[model samples]
Target: MEGETKLFTREELKCRCKRDDAVLIIHNEVYDVTKFLADHPGGEEVLLEKAGQDASEPFEDVSHSSDARALMKKYKIGELVECDRVQTKNSFSPNWNNDQSQEQGKCVIG
Candidate 1:
């Protein structure tokens, strides 16, 4: 954690996103997570739901769920400041519902 730092602030996220809905990116490329969060092994709301907002709450609120860690590793939805990692658009439209719940016995990861 020596180099660790807060990822993004509400203002920063808002500014980066410019109020738009978009996919998360680790490096470059479109990261088209738009339709994937719904199927993410961890329940969608964990990250997919808060798509464009400050995800600090859910990250800590659901600490007990391993899905948090898992999601972090795979998608690497780093600290709040990750908004700075890539450019954002103001399409801030998140589904938040992560409707994959309806799938039959999907057994979403922790």
Candidate 2:
């Protein structure tokens, strides 16, 4: 683990990635949420849009995996950076399909 990238706290990410787009590399999977913040169907008011210096609770309600959290160490990119878009719930936030609403608590992603 000596050479592994460091992990950025949720607070750290929230602080830097509000106004700009961010690539949240989780478990080798990535999520890009730049332009999507303003249009977020998850209540745009909930997400911070710029250096959320003291912002908290924005991402708390959202569910994420600890395995993904461990993987986060590989992607602690510096200083509110940007990257090519990656698959993220943001891009598909509006697509929370009700095709199987009865199957709540089930894994939504494969």
Alpha carbon lDDT of each predicted model: 0.41, 0.39
Model 2, TM vs. native: 0.26
Off by over 4 Å in 1: 1-12, 15-35, 41-49, 77-110
- Model 2 ranges off by over 4 Å: 1-14, 21-30, 49-110
At residue 7, give the lDDT of candidate 1.
46
Candidate 1 residue-wise lDDT, 1-110, digit = tens:
24654343334333333213434433211233445556666665555555554444444555546654454454443443322332223223365354433222222222
Give candidate 1's TM-score. 0.34
Candidate of highest lDDT: 1
User: Candidate 2's residue-wise lDDT over 3-99, tens digit each?
Assistant: 6443333333443454565444332223444555565555545444423332212343465357644544444353222221123334455656635
RMSD of each: 15.8, 14.2
Candidate 2, 1: how far from true, in Å?
23
